[model samples]
Target: MLPPASQFRAQQKRLDQFEALTGIKTTYSYVPYGQLLDKITTEAVGGSSEYDLFSFQDSWMASLVGYLNPLDASIAADKLDMGRYPEVFREACIVGGKTYGLPIRAHPQLLFYRKDLLGEVGAKVPASWSDMVATAGAIQNKSGISGVALDYVKGSGFQNLWLWFNCLWGHGSDLFDAAGQPRFNDAAGVAGTQAYVDVLLKDKVANPGSSQFNEYDMVNSMAQGKSAMIMVWWWTYSVLTGDRSRLKPEQVGFAPMVRFNGGKSPTLATLMPFGISKQSRHKAAAWEYLKWVSNPDLEVEIVCDKSDPQTSDIVATQTATYLNDKVNAVNHGLHRVALESLKGARILPKLTIWPEVASVLETTISEIVAVGKPVKPSLDDAAAQVARIARRSGRHRS
Candidate 1:
C-alpha cells in the first residue's frame, strides 16, 4: 500500500480488532507505488511470499491472476455479497469469470471547484466538457486566478491520463476496441485529445504551472487557492477543505465530471483490492480478514471516525456506505456525488500488458502536451507500439 503511513496504521488498528475477535494476528507491508509491481512479480516468480494477502491496483490484476487464489468457493461458502460494491469495482476483482479478490478502496473522479469563485463569476457548475471550458474561461477573466489546475507532467506515472480519460471516453472513444487492438488514435480520440490540450494551449484557462504538475501539485493548487477548479479523485475532499487548505469548508463544492455534448459521462474509476495469495498457508484466515475489513459498517466507522487523525478516511467502496445518512453528514455529501460518478465510470482494459501499454501512452501524451507535438501522429505511433506489445504478448484478438 502507498503511504501517508498514518492511513495504513489506522487500518492496522482495525486489523488488531480482527485479531482479537478471530485470534488471527496481522501485519502489513508498505511499498512505494513505483516498487509494488516489481515486488509482487518477484514474489510470484519465487513461488513463495511472506504476505498471505496482496493488496494491489486493478491494472495489475490480469498479470497477477495466476499468483492469486480464486475466491469463488470461499465467497459461496460464506454467502458473501459481492453486490455490495458498484459493478465497475466488482468487475475489477474478477478475471476470466473467476472471483480473485474483494475491493477495499475505490475512487471516481469528482469536479472539485470553489463555490465562492463560481458564484462571483456567475458561472454554474459545468455538466459538459464545453461548459466546463467556458466556465473556466469566465473564472479566469473575472476572478483573476487560474480557472483550473490539472496534472500534465511528463512522467510520474502519467497522472495526466486520468484527466484525459474523461474526455476520451466522453467522446465515445476507448483505449482499445472490441477486437483488443488500440483505437485511441481514431478520429474521436484525436478530437478528445485536442480538446484536452486546448485548455493549456489555445484557451489558456489552465494554471500556467500545470505543464509540470502531477496529481499532488494539482491538488495543492486548489488547497492554496491558486485555482478555481480541479477534477480529482473523491478522496481529495479532506485535503481541499482540511487544515492545509486556504479556503473554508463552505467555500468548496463538488460535482460530477463533465461530459461531451449529448455523449456519455464516464469518469475513470480506480480500484484497490486485496487478493489472497495462492501460496498462503492460511487462506481461510486471510479470507476472514478480507471479510472483516470490507464490511460496510466498518467502512462507515472508519470514515466517520474523526477521533484518530491517522485513521480517518473519506473514501468508501460500498454503495451502502456511500448512501449512509451519517456518513454524508460528516463528509459534506461527498459520497452522494461519488455514487453518481461511479455509476457510469470506466475501468482500464483488463490486460496483462497494461503496464507496457500505459507507459507508451504516457510518453506519447507527455510529448504532445509538454513539447507541442502533433496529436494524431503521436497517437498513431503509440497505437502501433501498443499493437506490437499486444502481439508479442500473444494477447491480441484478431
Candidate 2:
C-alpha cells in the first residue's frame, strides 16, 4: 500500500486485527512508488518471491497478468459479491475475461481549491478548463497567490501523462483508437496539450515551481496556503484536513476535475489491486488473507474507524462504504463527492506495453512544458514512437 501516513497507521491496526482474528501472522513492507513495479515484477516472474500476497497498481495489470493466480474460483467458492464494487474498479482487476485480483485502493482525481480565496474574489468553482483558467486568474489577482498547483514533474512514471489524458479525454480524444493505433497527435490532442501547457506558461496561474511538482508537492502547496487550487487524488483530503496541515478544514473546497467548455467532465481512476502470487507455496493461506482484507465490512470499519475520528480512509470496494451515512458524517462527505466523480472516471489502456508507451508520451509532454517545444511536432514524434511500440507488441493491427 502506498499509504498516506494516517492510512499507513490505520492499515497496521487492521493487519493486527486480521492476525488476531485468524491466528495467521502477517508482516507489512512499505515500497516506494517508483520502485514497486520493478520489485513486484522481478520477484513474481522469477517464481521465488518472499511474499505470498502483493498489492500492485492497476496499470501494471497487463504486465503482471502471467504471474498472478486467477481468483474466479476462489471468489465463487467464497460467495463474494463482485457486483458491490464500482464497475470501473472491478473491471480494472480483470484481464482476458478472468479476474486476476481485487481492488483494495481506488483513487479518483478531484479539483481541490481554497473556498475562502474564491469567495473573496466572487469566483465560482470552475466547470470547464477555460473557466478554471479564468477563476484561477481571478483568485490570483485578488489574493496574489498562484491560482493552481498541479503534478507536472517528469520521470515519475505516468502522473504527468495522466493529467494530459484528462485534457485529452475532455476534448473528445484519447491516447489510441479502438484499432489501437496512436491518435493523440490529432487536432483535439494538440488542443488538449496546448491547454494544459498554457495553464502554467501562458496563463501564469499555476505555481512556477509546478513544472517540477509531484502530487505531494502540490498538496503541500495547497495545505500551506501557497497555492489556491489543485487537481489531485481523493486520498489527499485526509492530509488537507488532518492535524498536521496548516490550514483549517473549512478553508478547502472540492469539486470534480475540470472539463472542456462543451464536453462532459472525465477523471482518471488510479486503482491498486491485491493479488496472490501464482508461485506461492501457501496459496490457500494467501487466499484467506486476500478475502479478509477485501471484505466489505472490514473495509467500512477501516475507513470509518473512530480511532483518529477525523481522517478517513478512501475505500475502493463496496458501495456501502461510500454511501453509508456514518462514514460520510465523519469524513466531510468525501466519499459522496468521490462517488459522483467516479461517474466520469476511466482507467488507462490495459496493455503490457503501456509503461513503455507512457514513457514516450511523458517525454513529449515534458519537452513541450520544460523547453517550450511546439505541441504538434512533439506529439507527432511521440505518436510515431508509440505506434512503433504498439506494432512491436501486436496491439496495433494498423
Candidate 3:
C-alpha cells in the first residue's frame, strides 16, 4: 500500500489496527507529493508494481483512468451503497461511466475567525464578501493586527485558484460555459477577480506580505495570533486548537464561506480517493482492505478518537458519519456546520489538462495581485491560454 506523507501517520495507525483485528499483514510505503504521480504512472505502465493500493487526489482521476481498475464490480459484490456518500464526491470517483475509486478524505473551505477578537471589537461574523471586508477593516483599526490572512501567493498551483473559484461561483460565474468554452473573462468573472484582489491591494486588511503566503502560512498566522481570521480548509481546525497553537478551542469560531449578497453560498471540495492499481498481484485482498478501512463506523471512530484528543479531522465521503450524534457532540457541532457547507460545494473541473489550466490561472492572478497588472486584461490573457489548451486537447472548443 502507498500513502502520501500528509496521511502517513494516521494511515499507519489504522493499518496496524486492521492487522491486529484480522490477523493480516500489510506492507506500507510512503511517497512524497511531488513524486507520487510519476511513481504511479511509471509503475502502472510497466505492468509490474509492488504496491497493491494507492491514494490520489480527485483531480488526478481523469489522467489516471487508464491505469486504474474500476471498483463498480467490487462495490456491487460487497453490497455497498454509493448513495451513502455525497453526490459530488460520488461523481468525482466515476469517470466515463465507471467507478474507479472510493472517497476517503474530503475538504471544504470554511471561515475561521477569532471569536474573542470579534466580540471584543463588537463585530458580528461576516455573511458576505462586502461585510467581510468592512468587518475586517473595523477589526484591524480597533485592534492592532492583520484583519485577514489569505493564500494570495503565486506558483502554488490550485491553492490560489480554490478561493478564486468560490468568488466566481458566488458571483454567478464559472470557469467554463456549458459549451466547454472559457467564460471567466465575462463581467461576473471580472467582478470576482477584482473583489479578491481588492482584499489585499485596495482594502489592505491582509498582511503586507500576503503575496508569499499559501494555505499553511495563512493557517499558521491564525494559530500564532498574527491574524484575526482566515478562509481555509476545515482540516486546519486541528492545528488552530492543537497543543502548540496559542489559542484555546473556545476562542476559535467557524462559519460557511462568505457569499455574495442574495447569492447561494458555494465552496470548493478537495477530495482524496483511494484506488487499487491494475498491476497489483493481490487485487482481491486489496479490495477487502479498502472496504475495511473505509467503513463508516471505523471512520466515525477515527474522527472522534479520544486518545489524541486534539485532532478534529472529519470523515470525508460518508454523510452518516458526519450526522452521527457522537461525532457532533464531541466536535461542538463542527460536523453539522460542515454538512451545511457541503450543500453548495463543488469539485474542480474533471479535465485531464486541469493542472495546466490551473497553472495559467494562478500566474495571471499573481500578475494582477503582485505586479499591479490590470484585472480585465490579465483575465482575458488567462482565458485565451486556457482556451488554447482545451482546444488542443479536444475536450473543449474555443
Which lDDT values do the candidates have, in the order given? Answer: 0.86, 0.82, 0.82
Q: Tens digits of per-residue lDDT for model 2 on 175-202?
A: 8888888899889989888888889989
Q: Model 2 segments beyond 4 Å from truth?
A: 1-9, 261-263, 306-312
Residue 122 lDDT (model 2): 90
Task: Name every residue pair that clashes in candidate 1.
Answer: none
Give per-residue CA lDDT, model 3, range 89-139, as digits (tens): 888898999999998878877788999989988998987788788888988
Model 1 whole-model lDDT (C-alpha atoms): 0.86
**Given candidate 3, what's the lDDT at residue 147?**
93
Record all residue pairs in model 3 with backbone atoms less than 3 Å apart, i.e. clashing: none
Per-model TM-score, in order, reads 0.96, 0.93, 0.94
Instruction: Give the Cα error of residue 112 in candidate 1, in Å.
Output: 0.5
Give the CA lDDT, 0 to 100, for residue 284 in model 3. Answer: 88
lDDT, candidate 1, 107-186, per-residue tens: 88889999998999888898777888899999999988999998888578768788788888877788889898888999
